[model samples]
Target: MTVDCAVIQRETPAPERPHRRTEGPVRTCVGCRKRELAVDLLRVVAVSNGNGHCALTVDQAGNLPGRGAWLHPDDRCLQAAFRRRAFGRALRITGSPDTSAVVEYVRAQTGAD
Candidate 1:
């Protein structure tokens, strides 16, 4: 289920254009391969401490500070992300948003389950 960060990174905005919005800031789902806007996607980031590491966390607030990746906010989008490993590939890490935790987060964030 692992996608490649290189691919997602290719589509992400260039460093100088962080705030600029392109007509097609679309990203693909590592799971279903759907093309969608990056913002429509939920941001996922990993949390780590001196303790070594923690589960992947879903950033519903879209404000988490580490290297982040995204997925469209939907059950299908979520399934795709997990099944395809978009987060792992996008963030270039082996771990990311905890599944059940992310589902719950998404439920609360979007008000659905």
Candidate 2:
């Protein structure tokens, strides 16, 4: 007499890995002190033309070389940053960097005067 046997098959589950952040780089807004993606905020850098003058220029293309400070394009944020002197602290500047250009740029981009 011959006995019949049955075999059972089982499937194994794969292990899960931690998800990586693929939404680009993250940076903090100097004005509001909020953490946001780098691409969403504007990049500004202190520029010196070697003429005993320095100014803060908005790096719309985000390709300027030097210490960069990030901020939102909102007037409120701008005011807050200015009030708190975040630009100087962030950029390690002794005197206040000319922010008119940056304000104008932000205004133009955000349509806020």
Candidate 3:
């Protein structure tokens, strides 16, 4: 029996699919530790609260200066971050940062009491 080596050699190769490009910067949510587009996550920065204490402030425009930690706008994510004490570690701050503003913003956005 003759082997059809020519037929196998003549077969066309399958086309390769193009890789999808991410449009913007990607960030990981401190709460869930899930990677997501920066636009989809909320940016927060640590600022002095006038009492020599650092507090977490939401940077809606994402233009705030200094180190920022990312989190999803969901309440669950906020709670998880709080439960894990991730903000302090992620923001590289000593002691716990006030989360009232972040919590309030998330609550308002999620309409959660």
Cα-based TM-score, every candidate: 0.58, 0.76, 0.81
Measure candidate 2: CA RMSD: 5.9
Summarize candidate 2's per-residue lDDT along 1-113 as a digit string, tens digits.
99768777788787888975659988889999998889889898999857766799999888888899999888888889999999999998787778889988878877843
What TM-score does structure 3 among the candidates reach? Answer: 0.81
**Angstrom error at residue 20, model 1:** 16
Model 2 bad stretches (over 4 Å): 1-22
Count of residue pairs whose backbone atoms collide, per candidate = 9, 0, 0
Tell me the tens digit of each residue's lDDT in model 3 across 1-113.
Answer: 88766644576788998964599999999999999899989999999888879988999988999999999999889999999999999899999888899988999999853
Candidate 2 positional error at 91, Å: 0.6
Candidate No. with top TM-score: 3
Model 3 off-target regions past 4 Å? 1-5, 9-21
